[model samples]
Target: MNHSLDGQVAIVTGAARGIGLGIARKLKADGARVAIWDLDVAGCDAQRLGFEADHLQPVDVASYESVERAFGATVEALGRVDILVNNAGINGPVVPSWEYPVDAWQRVLAVDLNSVFYCCRVAIPHMRARGGGRIVNVASIAGKEGVQYISAYSAAKAGVIAFTKSAAKELARDNVLINCVAPAMVETELFREMSDQHIEASKAKIPMGRFLQVDEVGSMVSWIASPACSFTTGFTFDLTGGRATY
Candidate 1:
């Protein structure tokens, strides 16, 4: 059987670059019209993502008002939303829990965890009104295995995982399937935020002896956000390169 996303409208947060941009490319290639939401819309090339200028918008997912307006604009311009990729996130201060700054910790949770709830809260009503939709949260293997020196990032992602499962149950009968994609390590701009020691250690932990690619993660997300993904919700898909034991 073939999976086609013809006529679908998707919103990919943090899509100005990295994994989010990669996902937008794949989704557009797969026949879905995509909208990018981020703080600065500078890096996004509508031509590169095969979208029009109107599809890109500046949005701070951490702010409820920003999310609501951006989502409303998307529906107004694209017609209706069929998929949402919650990929906006940040890797806060890399320090032991005792040494992590309070502000950094709070910001990480606000962006990485609470933003998911905010985006979902605004998007779910639109989705349910449309009868169905798909939501794929971009979590991390750290959320599951808990990496050292990045306690805030690890905890926020774990919250995302838990929130996904709980939200799935709440929306089970509504036809809006929600799930998570937990990738171990990927080569992207996000790497610049990590220390050399941390990056090398992460790569060493993956049994495949290499980091995952952005396009590979994109492919997983595209499918999960398609009708082909029906019947599975609240599930966590791993892109860990053989490091996941469960």
Candidate 2:
């Protein structure tokens, strides 16, 4: 239960607020030095966020060039990267698939799905060279069971799940563990992007009768990212509050 990550360094994307911030706080509490990576870095204060000022990185995870630069900056600032949490994403527009704009679809995939690949592509080599590491991709239950209107978000998350599995297998022998978390609706700022009807419908699907909490996600991810999660790779850990049993 004591998933101590003492002395490790973790990079959590989109950590300026919401779930990313939650995960970063948990990692820091567990003894890992955390680097908060987000586009809105100007709003993050070291004293306010409880992280080192030097470790707050302004990264655009959707861009490979930006990812590479951020990775280098993290290594230079934190000494090394032990864990990479691909948590940056957007809900996109809550419109029907047929009505979904091509531009919106591309942007959603780029941020939600492509960003994961970009981060992993840049971080895996460094982790491999350092002997081993953990990568936890934040996926969604929509990926497993596609949501109605948010086609782009669902498709992007599905790609994340598949990517995590394939990459995990490739790194299994190298001591690098890659996995994903498929969570149901969590009451974050992301809800602002959904309609009132969609919100109620999503909540109704959960047997637990409530949305997930940030701390709940943080706790699960902390365990997954820790050495305590040894022997598990290429797995999709569900945080769906009974909406998903498999």
Candidate 3:
């Protein structure tokens, strides 16, 4: 697939590193002008140097106002945004749903789920103005299968999938397509943060006996964001390295 994303302007959140950075890099390589958004300004700068993309912005995806401001500035600087990738996320402490801290649960929901709302709420208008656009959300296998120890993260990601579906249906009428990619045990900084035992257990359960690569996920995201993905709105593409069979 040529998947020529050339001349498109995009915003990718949590893009300082990991899968988010991978998506940004792939989009840029496909010829999109990408703005990398991250909470860590220093990390964003370092990643920017590494990729040498079009732009970077420090954004708090959980705050609607902050998202609005950052996105506003991004559009003003980049001219317009045709693609939005909501990839900012955090996995709260691993514990049973009944025992998880209330604050931690709320925080996880805020970042993983609510941030999607914040970004879309702001970006939708821009898409409207542009006549059409694409939004590719970064969901997870936990969203579909409901991971045992990470109930809050699972629930929040599940919410993202639902939101993507709803938004896709609503926006498709206006030419904006929304979709999500759910990956399992991707080898990224976030995956490396897991406990050694958990990592071993995760590897053992995968049929591939290994984690998916970031660039692999990036390829799927790039396609979803491209004009080539027409006619498929509000769908979840599985990138789980065969672990997400249902």
Candidate 4:
């Protein structure tokens, strides 16, 4: 499928590496000018990565102030914001719910859930000014079917799913579409934060018998962020390899 985002400008959070980077690469490949937003901006090689030097934004999406600053910078540099990918997140410690530390739980929700709200709050006005836009929030199957050990991650993602739906409805009349992707386990650096047993268990649940690839996520997100995805607002598109039947 040729999902062309020609002449558009996209802001992808946490895009310095892993799945966020994958989404940024695909958006760039599909003809969108991408602004890479991440805390590790110093680690990115703009020339090597094919992103413009001016568009590399060091942003902490969990903070509204930081998100606001980044949004203004992106608009000043890129001219407009057509797509917003709330992809920055952290997989908190993989301990059981009761054993989950209080601070760790709060941190997970701050990054995974609150960051989505913060980014959307900052970008929606700009997108409205631009006439219309697409927003793709990266959620997870854990949100739908709660994961045993990662309660915080699961809860945060569930919040993302709900938030996407509500935001989509509010923007439907304004042509500002919002949707979310509920992907299963993707083999990223996040796996380093999980236990070996949890990893195997997650993989075993996938009918595809494999973890999701980053490019696969990019491909789906590219379509969702494109004009072709019209008529699909407030939806949770599943990328769970059949692990989630709904």
Off by over 4 Å in 1: 47-54
Error of 2 at 164 (Å): 0.5
Kindly report which residue stretches of model 3 are placed more than 4 angstroms away from their true locations once superposed: 43-49
Q: 1-246, model 1: which lDDT tens digit per residue?
A: 457889999999998888988888889889888888888997567566545544888999999999999999999998999999999999998899999999999999999999999999999999999999999999999999999999999999999999999999999999999999999989998888989999999999999999999999989999999878889999999999999977
Candidates 2 and 3 compared: the better one by TM-score is: 2
Pairs with backbone N, CA or C atoms under 3 Å apart (clashes), candidate 1: none
User: Residue 214 error for model 2, in Å?
Assistant: 0.4
Q: Candidate 4 residues 1-246, lDDT tens each?
A: 437899999999999888999999999988998999998798688675656533899988888999999899889988889999999999988888999999999999999999999999988998898789999999999999989989999999999999999999899989899999999989899889888999999999999999999999999999999999988999999998998988
How do the residues 206-230 of candidate 3 rate in per-residue lDDT, one tens digit apiece?
A: 7877788989988999999997898
lDDT of 1 at 181: 98
TM-scores, all candidates, are: 0.97, 0.97, 0.95, 0.97
Q: After superposition, how far is residue 173 of candidate 4 from its true place, in Å?
A: 0.9
Worst 10 residues of 1 by lDDT: 45-54
* Candidate maximizing lDDT: 2
Point to the candidate with the largest TM-score. 2
- How displaced is residue 2 in candidate 3, in Å? 4.7
